[model samples]
Target: MGENRIQQNEMSRRSFIVGAAAGTAGLAAAGLFSGCSAQPNTSTDNAEKTNSPTIPEEFTDGVYLTKAISMHGPINVKTVIADGAISEVTVLNNRESYVIGEAAINSMPQRILDSQCIDVDCVTGATLTSMAIQNAVSEAITLAGGDPGNFKGYQSPEPKEADVERECDVAIMGAGMAGLMAAWKLAENGKSVMVFEKMPYVGGCMPITSTAWNAQDTIIQKAWGTEQIFEAWSSVEAQLQSYREGRIEPDNPYYNPDMPFITPMFDAARDATDMMINIGVGFCPISDWPAPQLAPGAFSIGGKFCLDIVKNYLTYQLGVEIITEAPVTELVTNEGAVTGLVAKGADGTVYHIASKAVMLASGGYISNNELMEQYQPDELKFPLMGPPWATGDGLLLGQEAGAALETMDQGVTSHYSGAVSHAEISYIHYVCPGVVVNGSGARFVSENMEYKQALRVFKDQPTTDFYWVFDEVSRQGMVPSGNSYRLDYTFLLETGDATEAGNYQELAEKLNLPDLTATLDAVNECARNGAVDEFGNEKLRAMLLDGNMYAIKVTPTPYIAQGGLKVDPACHVQKEDGTPIAGLYAAGDVVGSVENRDGAMYRIGLTQAIAYGLIAGETMSAEL
Candidate 1:
């Protein structure tokens, strides 16, 4: 139940597992014990009498391994017991997202050891990983001949308060990708920087990000043989067209025609990519979807890799300070210029850090229901896919310091067909060659329309209820391709959100679409004759005429708010009069209008965060 005991147990468990597996047959022949079984023996009854097994005091001592399935994949844990006491727990393997899983992986094992039980509290914002870890530990305890239900963990002593004040050149709220990158840039230039993150872990939403950065002509794109496809002028024109056609909100109050931020940001993105590469970030070719013309020169990498590089370089190489589990509650402003902020540590200790400048990269308010209702009432009804920590803390802090917000009515709403979960949707795969219908069972729009257009169409549906109808062939094609991170078909089917029928009539009946039969017949006739549907989608018209059909319930989930505190090109929070708020800068989802580039044509958010973070860092370093 101590740190030393846990460490010893971990080492013992590894050795025991290796030895046991090596001599499995010999041990069985000698009748020393039964074959290795990961399942726990729950025959013992206790006061709680829960389904979980109760650890008996006279149980044997040994090492045990068990596997538990999590949201992403299986997690394997090894538990060691010594003299009938739970000694240690070790996570052998896990495939959970780094953003949500890393903290749990690092802390849960220790907590289990300290408590001498498997019922420790889970890491917040990481429910799946926490549950999986706890489950694996429970099995391991049972296998180690201990009753998990009866074992009482140690009671942790209350934390003592410490003087945690610090003075720095810059104080950043949030240790996300943007904040970390900015801290690195500033600290590298000989400035003292402190970054505070509310979460016990860093990375924010970066781990869930697409990890695709956009630029004009870049070295990677040139090497990939797709440089000629990305023309700067044409890309801008396409964005303008999207705005002009009202595909994006044309009534954006933050739209500044004279100061087109996209042009400058795109130009700097090339340098950002180069910087990333110099720092050892790797990339794969971007997926050629929505036409390569519209897709900027983009490449994919795991956001965790980028975050790890920035965190290590800033903390070890540049000496930037990062404190996690410290939430900044208020901005301490003096005169007309912003000065510093106050943050609270996990143990309720306050730290008032003074600084010459502050950057609000604490992400958007997608998860804040109050702010969502205040800014975007319509979108508040939908499920949110953004990080849980994006509770508008930065916006509130910036606004309290007299910064102006813009385009508050807009957000990034994605249309995907399935039950809501943490898994990333396969938009490109699901949107191809399918028939979308409303609650009334009537086809609403062309399935092959641009993603934004499809979202708009789905948003306008009655009750916002829709489904994607596809045949077996289409479903087979929907399987994630090589190295694609989208959810696989098997997983989707297992969620029970997708339904299948032998024929169109059965499918329609199952979906309660009274007119689905006739609709399918008409669609089939068009596909048979190679004709375009009413929505002018020839690609969709060529499919939906064959084999077993299916319908996936579709919903538009809010990913990130496209509007936040308005900022200038230098990433300075600006007032309505177009004047910058002195000493206060914003980046990432906290500063909006960047996502509305070319009228919200749907560019990569991660790229904008990195590019603008670098800009903010450089600007603050020079100006402050």
Candidate 2:
């Protein structure tokens, strides 16, 4: 099963007890006497005495819930209107159903605060806990002598103006595959859609990124196959065959979608061969050559053209409105419902649109320095490679409306062991002979294993630090399998950060290797025997040949933020105590990721982003 499905099912029953206890405590202290109106007298004093406002060890300095309130029965509770805004209810405990509690708590506060006190529906499976929290908070507020008649505890942000007031059924926040796919679906259904992008162009980290879609493809035979094409495509055909069989299940480490997904890649490749077609704003054909010549035989079968071409054709020819240089700011809520949003223009003006629902398709927080510290403080020290605009605006907007954050600790960043400021221009080679050493300068794993497997061994190693040691032979040229593992030679040669020595002894000395001779002996032994001593893999033996050598230090980097407005599968942001926030939903990377931080799955992050965006958009559009 996928990581998400497992998590959804694994939420223990203890969460229900915690939520129930908290609600009971809130009611007893408020002296509501089972649905009776709370009095502003000594009952609150007794309650306060029983439930002192002391911070628990788990929620030291952060904002946390300290109470839960439950009603006698499931009540169609109208949002508490206070000061023209809806009310917010914070759950003090974890006594409700796991997924339901989280989803409801995350959604309720925002809905109450935004709607200014109106009736809102409860999330499925969490209605009892939701009512308990809502009624208790209501009584608690009344006991405190606060105005409960007006949207009680919600505050609207100061209003801002927009540079453009264009109208669309859906306004996407990013132009990446997820956002683009959303626009395509909505547009295909005859719904007007607008895509806002912060980058100068489209393709959020995909154009230059090397990854395969996870799908199943049917093998096809072409009658006009040329020798050159056959030679170049044979390896790819074999790989695809492996994918078609049970060798590639959804959770497999090397699962790549073969059928429907690969079809797009091939289509994209074919489109690339013609006069570069316009896919979206700011995209062009990367090459104008025949498919077979793009790369050597089967090894050259990277279906870049397939995805790019389909992406381009849909954006340009399909009626998807993609507007670059726009960033969303405040969300517009009325009567505890999210109706639209306001985006900021490059000229410093705010633009507003009133849609039936809004989807947060913005990327993650890898690019935001402050957001990085708030969510993943340990990663702030490393060099970042994700796009510069992923500063957690989506998170901030959702939070402002009472959504709870989660995860805050899951991302897949390039791990180069050598001391370099930027990512290597090419993919790290799995076969290239190199020494994998921990921060203690000890060879910990086979240098020839898969990158994911190798890195997993070193993740919890002291300080999460490691380095890749290699000779010049493996670094200077293309190894077998069409992979260029070489670090930028010019950068290495010019900078000298990559140690240079005529022999292994000098290279070992510079790297502070404990035993230079032993490391060399192991490399040669592994090469001669066609096996890696630490991890047995034939692919490694072929790649690590003789070399002068290089070593690059790598520190762990977080590419995704796991925390943000907790939401249900339907994308409704929930409160801390299991109530739905009215009029708000979250999608894409800003929400808690479906994958665990250390799981072994291919395209997990991107796949979830696409799936959530797709589901959220469709749901919101259906509401329209």
Candidate number achieving the greatest TM-score relative to the actual structure: 1
Q: Please, what are the lDDT tens digits per residue for candidate 1 over residues 1-624? A: 223432453344334333323222111113322443455556554322433333335566666666664544456777676777778778888656665777788888888888776667778777557766777666555555557677656465676776577899999998876787788778878999999999887877667655665664455555565544533323435444444455344455445454366656665666677676677776655445322211112212266666777788788888998988889998988888889999988886889999999999999887676776667666544455556688899998898899998767655555453542324444634433567788878987877664533555566655666767777767765554522344344444544457888877789888899878788788878888888888887764444444588877766666676688988778888888989888899998888648574355455666677778888888998987
Write down the lDDT of every candidate, Cα atoms only.
Answer: 0.67, 0.49
Measured against the true structure, the TM-scores of the candidates, in listed sequence, are 0.78, 0.56
lDDT by residue (tens digit), candidate 2, 1-624: 222322332232224323433343213222221232344546776756544433222311121222432211111222232342333454444323222244466776665555544235444334445544455445344433334454344354454554667677766677765576666656666778777776544555443333322211112113223332333243445434544553345664324453443323333333222222223222211122112221111111222443455456666766777666667877888876667788776556667877755667777766566666555554444444444557778878877777777545443443342233232322344434456666555666655544433334555566455666666666643233334321223333332235566666666677676665575576677778877465554444422334465665654434444555577666667777768777566666666444331122233344455555555655666666
Residue 283 in candidate 1 has what lDDT?
A: 67
